[model samples]
Target: MKTRSKIEDEYWGALERLKIGKTKVVDTKSTRFRITKDAVGREAGRGKGYVRYERYPLLCEAIADAEVARKKNGPVTPSSNAKIEQQKALKQKAISDYNQLKQAYDMLMTEYLNVVRRNFELETGLAEVKNVKIIRMPSVR
Candidate 1:
């Protein structure tokens, strides 16, 4: 089981992205962002929570300001912004790890399939070294 790190927050908090319906200036033409409906309705579902569009930048700024303030104080608790940044970093790392694991799984599956095919071929006498070798004592000389 995965264990939390020293810096990891006891509670894993999250920010929700808006599901956009139309083309936006910031996103690619195919993709867009918007506040989801269920979230707007405050639906109590896992990972269904949402935050205002404006709050993100404000939180980021607060986190940055906290860093500046850190020099004055020895070690203060992280601001909301800093926690958000840490959450994002952890998410990105998780995604990277998932991709690598998926790639490895795919490769191993392919190799297994190939081995099965070769075994089938061998059993059906369709592979190389088709005939079994046998030794005779030359009619007892």
Candidate 2:
């Protein structure tokens, strides 16, 4: 079986190819979870993310993986929808954590790249400096 990190990497890489770029699934304690977007990254809360009974692709995948892992581990829980749902939620929590980590990692890399690019441009007199003088200081990012 693939490691959880491997699965998460594949999922994040797939998400990176999107025109929208990023997405998240949040399962709130309350009914319905909705997706929120901004000029920055995407956001979704558990239970508060989608409408009632709405199914999301990533969320489904997480649930399925959780179920499989649970089954493979041997101590099988009762085959009830409620039990399944609870397990799925637990699994989804792990996925959500990894998703947030991936998003933060992406954001950090992007910021670092931009900082490097900006520093390079300033040092080489490529970026517009107008009246401002940029000193070649050590990189902080």
Clashes of each: 4, 15
| TM-score against truth, every candidate | 0.37, 0.30
Kindly provide the TM-score of model 2 when superposed on the true structure, using C-alpha atoms. 0.30
Q: What would the per-residue lDDT of candidate 1 be over residues 43-133, giving only the tens digit for each residue? A: 2222332323353444334334543443454345689999999999999999999999999999999999999999778656643454664
Model 2, total clashes: 15
Residue by residue across 73-115, what tens digits does model 2's lDDT show? 5444467997889889999999999999999999999999999
lDDT of 2 at 61: 50
Tell me the TM-score of model 1. Answer: 0.37
For candidate 1, the clash count comes to 4
Q: Worst ten-residue run, lDDT, model 2?
A: 33-42
